[model samples]
Target: MVALKSGLKIRKLAATLLLLGSSCIALELHTDPAVAVDPVDAVCSNRMTLSVTGNLKVPYCSNKILDQPDLSVQRAVIVIHGTSRNADDYYQYMEDAAKKAGKLDGTIILAPQFLREEDIESRNPGNDVLFWTNDGWKEGDSSLSTSSNPRPAQVSSYDVVNFMMAKLANRNVFPNLQTIVIAGHSAGGQFTNRFAAGSQEPIVESTVIPMRYIVANPSSYLYMDEKRRVAGTVDKFAIPTAQEKSNCPNYNEYKYGLEKLNSYMQNIGVNKIRSQYAQRQVVYLLGEQDTDPNADSLDKDCPAMLQGKQRFERGTIFYNYLQQYYGSTIQGNHTKVTVPGVAHSGRDMFNSDQGIQQIFGSSPNHHLNHPTQPTYPTSTSNS
Candidate 1:
């Protein structure tokens, strides 16, 4: 009996050492400037293998291992990248935000990269790594399979997030973890908004870990209904006219209004999705000066134009629609925050005092103060 107890104690000591070593590796990755360069066809060094049926893996930059138990970590922030697929840059942005908020040591920052076929071609990450089409990842579409690099199984980007949350929910892994924040900007904003609507919220709910979503300057949003802001009006919403419908037939389709959902979203079904999203804690972070309708990266598709003119307008209108649609259901659950003097930049959006508060829940250097109304500036040419 004494020998068996000694053996168990030895195993416990080894596990503790493993956790400590993992934490140190994560800290080194965050502080190392050489590994945190601007992302241009770059993949993060750490790859998180999903606990799914197949041998699937996704590249990510994190300040802590998902499976390791770390008592110091109280919060987890998953920052998604935009159309550029620059997860490293987004990771650094959130890391800097956490530092500024004085929550660096207690926060686990993760930036998962959703690679494309072209990105795979440039880097040639192994066949087990999943690659999506150009816009597939943005809309929760399945990973692609090509003749050269056959994917073992088709996985949705949302499924990857579900798996991550499941890992974090493990009591043995994150006993002290209290919150999870999923944030994104631009195209990443689109992903966050849609994913929040369709994600398996019950996974974390069972563990009582509260989750919040921070959606920054996205070109469009996932409208829960067919109603849209009437043209030439700021707050008025109506179903598209017959002529408008004729011109833009698919305006209410998948990404825009849920007429057709991707495989992941379809499984969740529209009724459950709308109900869950209305009850979620979300903050729409918009930039005051992002008013240029002709900005190079703005989505000019008919469905997007149906939302609003530009990023700022689109966000404001959508929030207003949510208020009118959900009524008392979303009183304290949802909100809109606008960063003054900022325009279409992820760094500016995530580092502002308001952004820091939303990302870290609270900031030591600043107090949380959200403007009651969004202030828009005159149109200016800015990306």
Candidate 2:
């Protein structure tokens, strides 16, 4: 009996030690090692994973404490990644911009990774990460169902945005957060623009914090109306030409226009979305020299061609188009900055003087009487 009791005591001690070790590991995971030591180190370390659904968890990198955000942080920037789904690179770009603006310590930067189906299949991760089909998430498509991980209740990519925003809006989670900026480039730019326009829950209504959007060099924009931007015109919108119609019959459908929206957009009407977008603060960052018509990711589809031959032209045309249609509704809410020599590069665009200023330099007033002037910086960017 004595030997048996001693054996049981030893086993109990071993179990206690294991639990204590696990607790330490959990504590370590919550606290980023570099944050309190150095701002640059803080910005680059401690990427986190968030559970968005019962079966889905998304990976995100952040500068703030994942478990307990510093109350001193007043500004938060969520940087979305492009087609490559290289969110880590995008996060670094935001960190670099924050460093330039000298807002590195006071800002909380987040970059969420939206993986592809293939990415999961190849890795065969036991913990499921939220994923969308190739380019499907760009349009805020619902998460794809797979054999390894089935989502009976589908969640859209925009839903992830809603989730994160809601979390930030909570007073308990982010007591000092005053501003939140959503910015993206390339395919991510496409996501940000559309998400700004079509999100069912307007950020203003949902959160007390001021929210802004930065759309940089997207291949296309979702027109509020059936009209398409005519190339070479400063402000003109019309139906697609004969060739365009013949080639891209579904040009005005769903993502291109609001014809057949996905599950996430089904509840809201297009006009409501347009009105909400017009009232929100948005900045268009265009690369003045991003005029490459033949770039591989330039959205060469027929629907995209209706916008412009190149990204720079399309951005200008869209700005004019929005001003014409929305009239004064979007007057104080929209501004466009043209970056002199950057093109289709998130690193270059966000690191530029204008990029740093727009993103991290200053915070816009919640109520704007007039739109801020376009930033024209002569300094060169080394991205």
Give the best candidate by TM-score.
Answer: 1
**TM-score of the candidate numbered 2?**
0.79
Give the alpha carbon lDDT tens digit for every residue of 1-383 in model 1: 00011133555466557757797764444332112122234678788886544667998888887777898888889999988788888988999999999999998998888988766765766667887765778888877777977765677887777777767766677778778889999988999999989877653323356788899999899999999999988688999999999999999998898887776777789998888888777889999999988775788789989999989999999998998888856757788999999999999999999899888864222111211211111111111
As for candidate 2, its clashing pairs are none
Per-candidate clashes come to 0, 0
TM-score of candidate 1 against the unseen true structure: 0.83
lDDT of 2 at 363: 69
lDDT by residue (tens digit), candidate 2, 1-383: 00011133565466557757797763553332111110111112233334433545666777766457568888889899877676667888899999988898888888877766655654443345666765667777776666766654455677677666666665666778888899999888999998887654443433456778899999888888778876567577887788768888988887778888765565557777777788777899999999988775677767777888889988988898898888855768889999998877899999999898888766665521111221111111111
